[model samples]
Target: MIQRLLIIFIYFTGVSNSTAGQGQATLVVTGSVHGQLDPCG
Candidate 1:
């Protein structure tokens, strides 16, 4: 569980950082994911 959460955190952080631009908002919609859905905690 910890490992999976870690991977997700790293992935999202990397993606948001790379894709996000100045004065821009990143709309990340995670769906169709089994096991853990919605935001963690």
Candidate 2:
């Protein structure tokens, strides 16, 4: 469905933005993991 695709797009965009930081790769990974888990928990 269109809604599902839109959600996926937005989720990836957020992930991309979060991972674009400099000198903080671990923070990015931690943020992405938390983002994915906290929503379902």
Candidate 3:
């Protein structure tokens, strides 16, 4: 049982880490788009 729990924890942690990385990437892309739209600023 302990082994199973550990596996689940590790899986979830990996998934969350990946999701956070993706979120950061998305933010960076959005920032680039905004800069293009408002070049005068």
- TM-scores, each model vs. reference: 0.46, 0.43, 0.45
Kindly report which residue stretches of model 1 are placed more than 4 angstroms away from their true locations once superposed: 20-34, 37-41
Cα lDDT, all candidates? 0.50, 0.57, 0.57
What's the count of clashing pairs in each model shown?
0, 0, 0
lDDT of 1 by residue, 1-41 (tens): 56776676666667667645312323331432334565653
Q: Give the local distance difference test score of model 3.
A: 0.57
Candidate 2 residue-wise lDDT, 1-22, digit = tens: 4565456556666666775643
Worst 10 contiguous positions by lDDT, candidate 1: 22-31
Model 1 compared with the native: what TM-score? 0.46
Q: Model 1: how large is the Cα RMSD against the reference?
A: 6.1
